[model samples]
Target: MAFRRKNWMAGMLLATTFVVAPLANAADRVKFILDWAYQSQHSMFTIPADDGTYAELDLNVQVDRGAGSGDTVAKVASGAYEMGVADFYSMLRFNSQNPDNKLMAVMAVDDRSALAVASLSATGIKTPAELKGKTIASPAGDASRQLFPLFAQANNIDESSISWNNISIELREPILRRGDADAITGHLTTISMAIDAIGMKRDDIQFMAYSDYGVELVGHVVVARPEYVQSNPDVVRRFLRGAVHGYKKMVADPQLAVASIRKRDPMANADIELARLKMSLDYRMLTPNVQKNGISSVSPERIQRSIDQVGPVFGVDPSTKAADIYTTEYLPDRAELQLPPTGPASSTP
Candidate 1:
């Protein structure tokens, strides 16, 4: 009788071990849908995927280019994805519409508003003041749509006078050729890539820096919901560590970075990638190094500025606390923040 009892106890122990061991062995699967087509604008993301960092953290990951930042929000809010890269405004919109939304920013992708309005060079549209009555092509309902006209008004252009032609980015170049639009207000990456696609020289087109106007919107960011963060805080921290690592590696060696992205998307434009990289290096996009070194942070003031401008158009209250929208808890330690020595960092883009 004693032997039979012992055998039954052993069997129960074995079953429990079997159950717990697999639970311990299971790795998290994380998918990050991008807010837009991959480009140098997203160079910060290369950190986690290429460097074996995510695997070290026990995460299997995939990143899909998104149709818009808002699309990423919808997927994330639906719990269809664990992560996404998106615009600040889209996140705010999602917060308003989804009572259950827990989206939170993990890292700033561009940090700066490197987005711009580029015109074909022969038009002499060098300044925003010159954009009056000109047709501007853009993605309607884009976060920028709310911000761009406010930007135009700051630059002394009557926002209402400018005709907006809603077109898919794939179709923006066609509108430019057909004279349906005089300029495009879009990502700096898009403008550079479009010129590269047509084999056109920068000398052939004029790019008016959006900053020259007043659209101070924060660029894209990596985000996840609060529940996910609570359940996988370690994973989030490790992913951010990898991202910071990748940003340092990319700026240090853009040629190799562009080569890697090209391997993924054969149609990827290398010149624009290089140009965007050069421009990023010029601006503080990857900036505010450590001595004090670490991944640079988004200023509360800057974030508030964008949120304030977006409020009237989007119906969001401008005065909402910045903390209500973003949190920076996942950043790395001092040693991880120092950037490699850049050679004579270029002008602020």
Candidate 2:
């Protein structure tokens, strides 16, 4: 009887090990890259990671910082990273150049373009047309610089009239601050915060938003290599579902988003990041269309219009279709992606 008892115990132990092994290895490891350094906007992924939203979906996702949108696109296209967030226009340009290694945007994050040309209020430049004959500072590959022609065309500013002073990303705000460049082109939220960091008052900076001039362009998107997406459609779907849940949490309590950022970078300023989050929510992420259709969904007509506007600027091949750049196939149902009520609650009185 003792021998029988020993054998039975061993068998039970083996069964338990088998049961736990599959659960331990069940999660699909996914590598995700961000569009830029850690900021409040990146809370979309960090919150999910911290709250185990991705874990619930059996996804073990690792999120990393990125250099830029264009660089993110190149890494995803090369399969160096499985997924990344990037400017949709960068993906369009990449597709035009590297047709064979195409990347596809699965979700639209920023519904409105934050692209803008910022100048000091002291410059007395308030309109897009005022950019004429002004020297603008920008990085060569900046999304704002790349799309300036479209912005100029919309406002009837002669593209050649303005001279570009190509500079590093770090120099954009400083050059504009020193009055070395008349203006600088970059994302409104990023440039605004950078300028404010240099001890400049908010009222001292002036912004000429591209969207104000009839440029109907979409902003950042979540992208992946087409082959990876095709092979792991379910993974793609699960990742997006996790992302939507994160955004909903962000909308409900933006402080939670800031907490996620602070967790990653202890040195990050809670005040600035929180302000950046609100600015992005107000100006770029939470547009009227996003409020209506929910997050991560793009209108086919609007995307086509954006492509039409951007194609001439980037010299995109005329044959490339809008469908080639963006797709809504992997998105969760609209109901699952809706934002919590944004309006203030009625007073109890």
Candidate 3:
């Protein structure tokens, strides 16, 4: 009886050790913050996390919703987060202002900016020229509003001719719906929220994409603090690899990506996120350049042009260079980063 008791105790101890060993060898920890609340466009980040893509690369990632692109950049730069997603232009501006404390964009998420003027079809405000004598409603801090100068110059519209009705974010769409304003300036995904809130049909909305009018600028990007990158280069590489893997999965089935988003923000409407994700993928993410060079990559000339264009607009230091905005050292091979074609499908709740 004593011999049997000893064997049983030894077996239990071995079982406990085996169970604890893997947990002790845990994955590298990374905290990622998004440019905004958990929305459809952020599925690439969330889905990879929810679906275990980060874990597959031995990355134990924690993702948090953010206030805005500027806020996200500040957070990463201040060491509040190890990494984040933010507007590349905003990142560049921040770098220019604080030359010593710089954040480098690892991946260019969208080849073209999704900034646009969204209006009701009834308004017939389709072109930047059409908005010449009209009133535009938007938050004072809105990205599209900040970039309006470039958009205006590209389309040859006189900026002085238009009036900006600086208002709260929630009121921008409502005033437009009531015909109080001619149009609203915001990202396509953000504008879609108002359309959904007002119960407007898709056919009733028109988007004047900045890219369509010769405003060549990169959109959102995955960014990291320069110090963090220098300290953990391998971790950065693994992080980008996991993100690209997750993004590919998202492109193949955006519905699944929406599900992953819902998991993060249970209050999110699936249908709305689904539509937003699809629109973002088609209109913003899947550009001709991205198709050829893969997501997260950019052309040197275009990026340099963007730096030259935005630097003066945002008061960037004359010493700031295009290379200061982003780096390609940590990106995976272009072939591995190509996103598959999106298909017509829905997630099974």
Candidate 4:
């Protein structure tokens, strides 16, 4: 009888394993690529990923670093990555060029443009007009560089007057420090922090944000191929829910969010990342529009304005509509995306 009892227990254990295995494997695997290396802004994805937010939604997400916005757009359009964080304007250009393989933004993450032309105070570059006849160092595929023509058009800077020095991403700040270039164009927070990392005070750098110069373009967004989004609508919705939870958590406890970056990149400086995260939140992510409308929401008029501004610069297909670029179907409910009162602050480093 004891032997029979032992055998029954063993049989139950076997049955349990069989039952749990499929459930364990049932999670929808997702590969999420970022616009650049892991930074504090990325905590919106990493925090939720590490803290069981994605798991709660049955999502097994793998976050990977990206080369740049342009690369991320291409990778997602090619279906190499199911989702990616990328510049909205860069995706616009890609869609215009590849209408058949269009990528669409499922969520507008950064409501304000961080695209800027930054220089040391010593450069005496006080305005966008002053950027003419100067050397601007940028990556060949940088979104900021791609959008410079639009910036120049709005600010009346002759696009032909500025010389673009195509450099690798690693050299962006170093070239500026060495004075190899008079200024650099990239995400404002990223450039400022990089300058600060290399022994220069962020305040010493002067930034001419595109938004301030009549180029009110939207910033980075979460993107996926339109076909993938249509086929896996539920998966996209779940991912956005998890992402909103992550962003809310990051805003509530920035220090925790910054620390989460170390899980993927052990050498990342939490202090610097925290500062970067805060700068982005203050200037880009948590803007008045985002605060009022909730995260991932866009105004139709504003998006139309952006499209109007970017259309000529990118030579976008005349038929491309605002609806072609973004969709609100996957965003979480407004309540879930609302920021906390104590936004972007931390109790400790």
| Per-prediction TM-score to the true structure, in the order listed | 0.84, 0.94, 0.89, 0.90
- Model 4: number of backbone collisions: 0
lDDT tens digits by residue: candidate 2, 235-329: 99999999998888887788999999889788889999988888888888887677777897678778888888788887787766768777899
- Runs with alpha carbons beyond 4 Å of true place in candidate 3: 1-24, 341-349
User: What's the best-to-worst order under lDDT?
Assistant: 2, 4, 3, 1
* Candidate 2: count of backbone clashes, pairs at least 3 residues apart or interchain: 0
Query: Which residue pairs clash in candidate 2?
Result: none
Backbone clashes under 3 angstroms, per model: 5, 0, 0, 0
Clash pairs, candidate 3, are: none
Give each model's whole-structure lDDT. Answer: 0.72, 0.87, 0.82, 0.86
TM-score of 1: 0.84
Q: Give the worst 10-residue stretch by lDDT in candidate 1.
A: 287-296
| lDDT accuracy of residue 251 in candidate 2 | 73
Candidate 1 accuracy as lDDT: 0.72
Candidate 4 structure quality by residue, lDDT tens digits, 244-279: 988888888898988899888889998888888888
Model with the higher TM-score, candidate 1 or 4: 4
Tell me how far the alpha carbon of residue 272 in candidate 1 is from the true structure, in angstroms, after superposition: 4.7
Runs of candidate 4 exceeding 4 Å displacement? 1-25, 343-349
Candidate closest to the true structure, highest TM-score: 2
Residue 190 shift from truth in candidate 2, angstroms: 0.5
Against the hidden true structure, what lDDT does model 2 obtain?
Answer: 0.87
